[model samples]
Target: MAARQGRFGAQPPRSAAPGRRCVMVTANVDIPALKARHPLVNVIEASGVKLRGRGRVRQGVCPFHEESEGSFTAYGDSQRWYCFGCGLGGDVLDFVQQLEGFTLPEAIARLEGGHRPVPVAAPRPAGTRRPKSAALPPRDPALLTAAARFYA
Candidate 1:
């Protein structure tokens, strides 16, 4: 029997089993170009993460989890983000994946198609004020020692 032809003279996928068929899908996308086009700062802002900083470093609340404190940090120079609170970190694609719950290919396609996630307005806890300086607040030695002991 002759195989059926698909669009562009491509042959239809063949069945591996008597009743089951296997299909292969491929995407031709420039990953570096995609990352260049979608920088971490823009992606973070698009996801409703309000960042505050003087230069390349910005801080905001972790969108992945609820917290009254801001533990999410984005480095504009490196085009990456890391949430100290949740320990999640990565580039723009990772950000999209985490924010939209998309797989690797899905995230890539979403970026290629210029489909950004809807911005979620995060509520600020009362009495929280934006710091005047860009520097992160110093960590408490006591807290650090306790954390070290717990982890150890």
Candidate 2:
């Protein structure tokens, strides 16, 4: 079984059988694609916080870290953030983590709207009983057969 922390700071449940656990983080997420999904105006309208600036990047106060200056910059192409003062940066997930006080897993889950690569239990081989005939001496065929019949 493999355990990983979820966005809410809880460890995700593991599969029944032990094996390699391949965790995919933003496997299908494209920063550019996500950025294009929502326009800057839409984001600005939806956000309670205000933003200022123009051109390719918008400037705002660092919500995740302490900052008196508007050091947080959001890139229009990537729809990500970078703080020169705190050196904190990343895509939407990182931004959410900082803004909402969410863990990595929690932020990812929120961005994804759910969990991905859902945990699945692997089938285990059933145990079988060996026949007594295989363990018995070859000369004692009758006895082995009788023992096998009795066991069966």
Candidate 3:
């Protein structure tokens, strides 16, 4: 009876303000499953790269750079790519990131068929680094004078 008291557990959630009902739905995304199901080859081809056979790897014109010949190689088993022209490589997420200049989350969303907003890098939080105009400590007067005289 206790287990059946609520949809999930015994306690009715306290945050509903007594009259409102709240529901929580979580998706435990299995990355490996997604990777296996959606091959990098498909994603690459969908993005307009024309792949050709090159032994175990598939070769295409380097999407990340301006190249006439095929220099981008995508491995079928690994679901990844590397560029001989630009020397860049990584997994599916990385390829999307490099190709579209989208942030990690944006790339993942695109790969999973989720709605993607404007593709731009996410802003990092401000922390240790100083601003460009941050004042520097006053230089030693003797050192400044010496440097000025040397430059003059």
TM per candidate comes to 0.61, 0.45, 0.54
lDDT of 2 by residue, 1-152 (tens): 46777887768675433564445555766745654554543343244334677767888665455455778777776566677888988765555566567655555565556432122223223342222323544577788899999999
Per-candidate Cα RMSD to the true structure, in Å, reads 13.5, 23.9, 14.7
Clash-forming residue pairs, model 3: none
Give me the runs in candidate 2 sitting further than 4 Å from their true place.
1-47, 114-152
What tens digits encode model 3's per-residue C-alpha lDDT throughout 1-152? Answer: 23336666688434544674433311445667767766787777767677898556899777677666789899987777899999999987787778788655556667677533223433334332223435688889999999999999
Off by over 4 Å in 1: 1-27, 117-152
lDDT digits (tens) for residues 1-152 of candidate 1: 46778777868655555664432222467778788987888878877677888588999878887676889999988888899998999998898888888766767777776555434557556567544435777999999999999999
In model 1, what are the clashing residue pairs, if there are any? none
Give the worst 10-residue stretch by lDDT in candidate 1: 18-27
* RMSD to native, candidate 1: 13.5
Rank candidates, TM-score, best first.
1, 3, 2
C-alpha RMSD (angstroms) for model 3: 14.7
Q: By lDDT, is 1 or 2 better? A: 1
Clashes of each: 0, 2, 0
